[model samples]
Target: MSTKRYCLTCDLKDDEALIAEYKEYHKSVWPEIITSIKEAGIVDMQIYLSGNRMFMIMECDETFDPVKKAEMDANNPKVQEWEQLMWKYQQGLPWAKPGEKWIEMEKVFQL
Candidate 1:
């Protein structure tokens, strides 16, 4: 398995609401969304949050491409829906571009 790490950040304000929404929605992530993720070659995925920052860790096959995964997400209706709903509880950093809910982080170290 190939392991990779990515990062994203949201706002700490309304963290309770954000966590609640995350828990609630994850209880039933749409089938298509799950399929899309798996199909994109993601073997395992996890997100960790502290303050308002989120760190995403993913393990995937050699075929995984972050660019392709993003394209698939953009074209998937379920993903769009989920993102829209999530935005209700989350806030983006001031530097985030318009319409961007999550800002990807730079990878600086790996062990």
Candidate 2:
């Protein structure tokens, strides 16, 4: 099986305490969220933090469709809850649309 990779970027609230809290929450992500992610066809995912900046690496099979996942998440109460909770720490890039989050990064170099 082959997989595709995507990188996304977002910014945190830039408060030390809030950043610590955010990392703690990631230490044990809820089971429901894990299941939802797998169901979305994501093969592997990881997030990294640098100061107030955040980057996510998502690897998925051809079955993954981000648009479809967004639709599914919209109807899932657990997802809604998770998103609302994360909003306390996450912020969209300045160039992002009003309601957009996790702006996709362009792959300028690959080898």
Candidate 3:
């Protein structure tokens, strides 16, 4: 079976202390967040950071559906709480829709 890959980008507040706190929180993410991701059909996910910018890579199975995932997240209190907590460190991209956190990246090249 083939896996679908998605790349997204977001930014964190430019303050150093806040960035550090953000990293620390990630070191031990809440269990509910992990479960939610797995249930959403994300096989693997990774985040990379540079200064205040962040890049995320997600590999998902065929069952993954962004709209369905969003609906699921909205209904899960733990997920909502986690998202709210994350917003403290996250900032939407300039062109992102209102309330959008991670902006999906366009694929321009592949080998």
After superposition on all CA atoms, how large is the RMSD of candidate 2?
0.7
**Model 1: how far residue 52 lies from native, Å:** 4.2
The 10-residue segment with the lowest total lDDT in model 1:
5-14
lDDT of each: 0.74, 0.93, 0.96
lDDT of 2 by residue, 1-111 (tens): 889998999999889999999999999998899999999999899999999999999999999998999998998999899999999999888898987889889999979
Which stretches in model 3 have alpha-carbon errors above 4 Å? Answer: none
| Cα misplacement distance, residue 98 of candidate 3 (Å) | 1.5
Question: Native-vs-model 2 lDDT?
Answer: 0.93
Q: How big is the positional error of residue 79 in model 2, measured in Å on the Cα after superposition?
A: 0.7
State every prediction's TM-score relative to the real structure. 0.75, 0.97, 0.97
Clashes (N, CA, C under 3 Å) per candidate: 0, 0, 0
Candidate 3 lDDT over 1-111, as tens digits, reads 678999999999999999999999999999999999999999999999999999999999999999999999999999999999999999998898899999899999999
Clashes of 1: 0
Residue pairs with backbone overlap in model 1: none
Which lDDT tens digits does candidate 1 get at residues 55-108?
666677888898898898999888888777777767667898887766777878
Among all windows of ten consecutive residues in candidate 3, which has the lowest summed lDDT? 91-100
